[model samples]
Target: MRFLPSVQFIEQSRVADEFVAPAAVLANRLLDAKGLGGLPPCSVSYFIEELHRPGAAIGLHSKGRANVRLNLAWLAKLAQQETAPEWEVAFVILHEYAHFVLELLEAREVSPGATRRRIEAGHADFLRRMSHLGWLADPVSRKLLSNHNAIAEEWYCDAFAYWVAGTLPEPHAEFFYELLAGVRFPPTS
Candidate 1:
């Protein structure tokens, strides 16, 4: 049940080659641990390139296309560092992979729309409860939590990453736990 996507390095680099295989292995192991070994092999492609995003690094999962793009420069840089950001890199890859998995799970549903509505409602309720606890009083926090679908998707991805790694890197670790404490994603049937 090991799933290895077609990995392509847009730019020729020893660093990219060195990391892709191990990253894929980590991803597969995580998936297997999560009982997702039942998923049929998919034609997902992993493209390593400079994402051109204005952040330290980023990864993207093209919706419905099964294409995951990881920041090549970032991977290379992380590898060259004294303290390799193994957890960070894993998080990026797993988060994007979660998006692909979530889409696949939704596609398997008899009623995808109903599934989405349930997710949105559940997430909205969570936000409301958190707000009542004065946890989301900050304007920035409120604005970010305003979009149920977006926040839910991000939270699900984060949860998947946490589930895979069994932990999350700092700054995110505490928030992620609090955000997903009682949420059941895709809402179990």
Candidate 2:
């Protein structure tokens, strides 16, 4: 598959080329299907292990560097599974791409401060409701909601993934629903 000019796949993992190649192709297809085939140049690197974080993270986006890091170990495992692992992997890629897009939007001031503020407010309100419902009691949820901006950014990213993919993978549906309850995408213009 021909990848978008904006995205380059960087292989820095011990996983077999057979596994990495398919994942990269799937990622490209996912982005292209979502109409995100014209983004600015950025690298998507596959790493040998999960990123150092509080929870089980399969992917991460580095805003300062404008790049994405995926866990090759995780992808390899998924590739071996008989079920539809591609869907989950697609979600992860799109989630990170959402972060990249968010950073670009903010850096270019595409919608100025209004978009960020709306996302923050929407996510803050979602958190408040979740807190009242005791959903924040879970350690993973707590860690994910460490701060206002962090949670807001996460909400937007997850929402973008869902929006682009049409559905969250079954395993992540509940968690994503909780994070994105009432958070609508801000107007692009």
Candidate 3:
């Protein structure tokens, strides 16, 4: 995968470090170990500044391809603190990569009209299932039912992170684990 140009900001008192390298390696290791090899090549770029988006999202992935942009400000904070868990950075990278993989899967679909609707409905169905599994109050899952494409993409990414890390403290994490229980290894085309 080709990495695009990235911008970094570090206080003059602190030394800049290669955080991206280790994060990428960890993300790749999880993807390979999980047998999710169908995803196309992708790149991740890091920045110490806030993204131009309106909310406080820590990362962003391109919708149609395997590319990610991470918030280095958050990463650097985690790097400097001893209390920060090792899986934090890796989870962020893996989640973004999952978004790429899902989008690649969607784009590769060659079926006609109803197929697209069916795929979206499948994702929505999963979200609805989560509600029944005790995730009814989760904001993300609630959005999932109405915001098909983007919310489903986020759900898939979060599920990938949960799968890699083995646990998530979030209220809706159980929903992801339940989904994982039924998925076939290496994933079908």
Candidate 4:
């Protein structure tokens, strides 16, 4: 995707100012690869570490911008596994991006009833649209849906992450499969 000049790239370390910390360059690269590299001014705010947790997590608000908390220990663990922790980081960004898309498309109608209606009414169309965009090729497994809220917006974000990863710089079938393997839904045609 082409990046416009309106985007601003904020380094995590700069936010902390007076401390030596783990670098978030990989995380930055992942967001860039996913086409959300630069945020528009207050559109996004990133913090290097968290006051409580020690892993990559995000605290979101009703509005667009969010505080992304990246934990060093969690990233180191993810790095030692295989692909960079960026995939998960990318997912974090897309999770918020999904919120943005939903708000834009739905005109701020994000209530539970409205969301479920949208998901159900647009179910086929949603999958088809995502599939046409090459998002549905990844099958959601039964293990995950078993424990997750089937009608939740979080599911949409998870599905979007899989789709973005496929089309972005890292096409990770294995990691995605692992993510989907936890799906609790039964397979369907």
Candidate 5:
């Protein structure tokens, strides 16, 4: 389903309109790409909040609920960076949307919740794939990979976002392409 702004989001538009509107536009593009590839229909609700952390955005979806929270402070900080590219904000938004897509696919499964083994296996597969790209050895990437529970989803989102952003490296990009292409949601009428 197309991303739908939450009622609260619309009510608070005056406070976040400048950023939220643009992010929504980019989100639509990312969602369209996923839809064309067969991801499930799921509505996204977003809000600007004091995430109070460095993360610019976070996406959550499960059992039919999906939402994205954007950290205004972090986003402003990133925008101030001299090296920040024009597409940085859009990429951040798209990354979060990727999380929603993956979670929706998991939720739509016949048996619903994935087993711990399944999740761990997915994490292991991610590590192996990153290792091939020579990213696993990087200290920062290594630390993130070490916490499979906390950071595994980020890895998936990053792969999907980077792939769509046209920045994911070689075979890794192909990995996300096939991974997403495998989602088999019933066609929405």
Candidate 6:
């Protein structure tokens, strides 16, 4: 439950006024959040640049256990005009931390079907849409199905986010549940 090197983006100028302190506090708290003790040591990489496009992923969990990066560029923008900007930053960070923990706990060979079922149950609304799509156009669905390795990880990560911030204000949970409902990565056909 130790933090790695600090996540400093020298180019940061926007969220400097608001986000960084809370981000650091939340990251340190998460390292020992009890439920997330099994999670890997995730170091945040704050960047001053924009993501590939508009509304891209604000934070990403990658390279298994080493890195979890968050973009300060967007955060700064939100900070300038938004009330309680740090709370939003904290929420998204916990989401990425969820991804980190899932990667730490993942078995190398979890079957795609079993993994999908587990995730679907956890995210019940997606389960219904997926099941409906599975039934209505079985052939097309079979044709369209692709391995869900990364997506399954994302689902578990989403649940972890839910668990991590279960005590946060209601908007975070509502937004998270909405995100969870349409959670498929490649988009269901």
Candidate that would win on lDDT: 5
Question: Candidate 2's error at 121, in angstroms?
Answer: 2.8
Off by over 4 Å in 1: 1-11, 41-51, 54-65, 129-150, 168-189
Model 4 per-residue lDDT at 162: 49
Query: Which residue pairs overlap in candidate 5's backbone?
Result: 1-41, 1-42
TM-score per candidate, in order?
A: 0.59, 0.55, 0.57, 0.43, 0.59, 0.53
Best of the two (4, 5) by TM-score: 5
Quality of model 2 by C-alpha lDDT: 0.54
Compared with the true structure, what per-residue lDDT tens digits does model 6 show for residues 69-162? Answer: 5555555455445365555666566666665444433444255454446555545544444566665543322322334312655545544544
Model 2 weakest lDDT span, ten residues long: 1-10
Q: What lDDT tens digits, residue by residue, belong to model 4 across residues 1-189?
A: 111121121233332321112223433444445444443211234443446454545645455554444444344334445443444555555555555444544543545456446545433344344446464343442211333425546655555554545542222334333323322133222
The per-model lDDT (C-alpha) reads 0.53, 0.54, 0.52, 0.42, 0.55, 0.47
Off by over 4 Å in 3: 1-17, 50-65, 112-123, 135-150, 164-189
Each prediction's number of clashing residue pairs: 0, 0, 0, 13, 2, 0
Global local distance difference test of model 4: 0.42
Across 58-138, the per-residue lDDT of candidate 2 in tens digits comes to 344454444566665565556446674555665666667767676655665545785578668766765675577585354
Q: Across residues 76-172, which tens digit of lDDT does each residue of candidate 5 receive?
A: 4544455633366666667777777766657556665653334455657757766675854544345435553356666666656666656665555
1-189, model 3: which lDDT tens digit per residue?
A: 222222323442122235556666776666655555445545766555655432122344454456566655555555555553346666767777765555454555565443335435646666566657674445544443454335555656665676665554353445444433323256333
Where does candidate 2 stray beyond 4 Å?
Answer: 1-16, 50-66, 110-113, 124-150, 168-189
